[model samples]
Target chain A: EDQVTQSPEALRLQEGESSSLNCSYTVSGLRGLFWYRQDPGKGPEFLFTLYSAGEEKEKERLKATLTKKESFLHITAPKPEDSATYLCAVRRWDGSEKLVFGKGTKLTVNP
Target chain B: DVKVTQSSRYLVKRTGEKVFLECVQDMDHENMFWYRQDPGLGLRLIYFSYDVKMKEKGDIPEGYSVSREKKERFSLILESASTNQTSMYLCASIPRGLNEKLFFGSGTQLSVL
Candidate 1:
């Protein structure tokens, strides 16, 4: 069974504070990992896609790194506008594009 | 930019009533998906279509059905709405290829009374 787990269900950070969110997974064959930001009452917005271990992607203050068993989303000096739920998902290599998603981490950045 | 649009942002329906949630994507993507979001459960796939008239049951499809009559439109149907079925429904699309990144709609918040 493929499973994705995200830690720190909720986090509160002061302005300019940096922190990391974790996503651990167990899958038969890894295909790709995805990160998304979702605001209250809205759908998730695409962030990054990590295809292999040792891969990293960045956008503004957000940096995502991937490993064999886990992934990390590092937020640097976050602002109030950066507050949102971070979602992690994985796609298997079994010719299926279906994604398994974690519960997500709700981040609150107070300015 | 790829755009996925959901018809309604909020809906109120009574129990035992049938409900429809529509989604449309402008990216000409071949794959479309419907998911439900709940607290502590994240997002769970309800149904998906890879091509017009082709539908696949997802993780939680017991009380739901889907229709893909056209390439760019996907609709999720609730045969009989229930209180437990109240949730935030999301729609997403992805182009068929190695790029499995999905573009999501604004979502529909359905309330069953």
Candidate 2:
């Protein structure tokens, strides 16, 4: 079975504060790992797709890093507009083409 | 731009009543998926279709069903709405290929009373 776990269910950060959200996953074979940002009452917006360990991607204040067993979303100097739920999902090589997602970490950036 | 569109943005329903959520994609993708999101439960796949008239049960399929009569459209049906069924339903579509990501609709916030 494939599983994804995100740590720190909720995060509150002051503007300019930096922190990282953790996503631990277990899968038979990893095909891709994805990160998304979802606002309240809205669908998730795709952020990054990391395909292999030791890979990293960045966008503005958000940076994502991937390892064999886990992934991390690091938010640097976050702003109020950056407040949203961070979602991590993994697609395995099972041929199902389905993504298994973690519960998510709700980030609140207070200005 | 590629888009996935859900028919409704908000809905209120009565228990035991049948409900339908429609989704359409302009990306001409062969795969479409239905998922329900809840606070602490993340996104659980309810159903998915890979082609016209083909459907597959996902992680959570109880009390729910799906239809895909066209390649660009998928529909999710709740035979009998229940209080526990209140949730934000999301629709996603992905093109067939490696490294392709899903495009999601804005979502429908359904409240079953």
* Model 1 spans > 4 angstroms off: none
Q: Considering summed lDDT, which 10 consecutive residues are worst modelled in model 1 chain B?
A: B94-103
The DockQ value obtained for model 2 is 0.71
- For residue B9, model 1's alpha carbon misses the true position, in angstroms, by 0.8
Best by DockQ: 1
The sequence of per-residue lDDT tens digits that candidate 2 reaches over residues A1-111 is 888999999999999999999999999989999999999989999999999999999999999999999999999999999999999999988666678889999999999
| Docking outcome class, model 2 | medium
The per-residue C-alpha lDDT of model 2 at residue A16 equals 99
Q: Comparing to the true complex, what docking class would candidate 1 get?
A: medium
Task: Note the DockQ of each predicted structure.
Answer: 0.73, 0.71
TM-score of each: 0.97, 0.98
Q: lDDT per residue, candidate 1, B1-113, as tens digits?
A: 88899999999999999999999999888899999999999999999888899988889999999999999999999999999999999999987765568889999999999
